[model samples]
Target: MPDIVEQHGVPVLVCEADGVSIGTVQDALDHLIGAAFTGAEVVAVPSPRLDDRFFDLSTGLAGDILQKFANYRLRLVVIGDIGRHLAASSALPDLVREANRGQDIWFLPDLDALADRLGPDGAGRKTG
Candidate 1:
């Protein structure tokens, strides 16, 4: 299992190679709920750790997850380069662009950027 760390006071979840699957995502969610996720300003999901199988930017799974984050008013940070995703789907760039437009969702490679987005600098930017 990938260890969970707190970066700049925000919760950052690193995905283990074996944990990058639908089943393991539940565990990640559980870990978040059990941790400081309730009041967490930012929840960073490192791209390398995510199960690419279900993270298709144009697919329902990704949409569902984003919807849930919005419903909960949670800021979700996807940390990493998404060149692969951009190559896979022609719609991915737009999808990512739209997702990032929302305060709750962001796509970036830097963990510190995630912290800033979820910190005092990006406060009160809830979707719900």
Candidate 2:
């Protein structure tokens, strides 16, 4: 189950770190759709809950999952260290860097970093 918490004044659905990892596009869809029902604008997923394939740029799973979130206009935040994965993939680091610059998706180190980026009171911010 995901927890719905207010971070920076935004209703965010934070996925459990020890929960099942998202191994397929359907899994990603399920999480995104479920979060929508909670009226959450952002879904914060810990890196531990992401499929290993999602970190392999060759798998295309990451792109597909991200596309689904973008199509649904849902913001996704992947929290926790992904240094090892990034170190292995040449393209992933660039992808992560680019994603971080956008508003729709972000790759952060932790919830605290997310709070800082969103500010103390995340108000007047566009969701997706």
* TM-scores, one per candidate: 0.66, 0.90
Best by TM-score: 2
**Please, what are the lDDT tens digits per residue for candidate 2 over residues 14-127?**
888887779999988876556566788788899988989999989999999989888887888999999999999999999999988777789999998787777744432674
lDDT of 1 by residue, 34-121 (tens): 3425455556666765657546754466666656666655566777888887888877788778867676678877766666665666
lDDT of 1 at 85: 77
Worst 10 residues of 2 by lDDT: 119-128
Candidate 2 — which residues are off by over 4 angstroms?
120-124
Clashes of 2: 1
Q: List pairs with backbone clashes in candidate 1.
A: none
Maximum-lDDT candidate:
2
Clash totals, every prediction: 0, 1
RMSD of each: 4.0, 2.4
CA lDDT, candidate 1, residue 4: 58
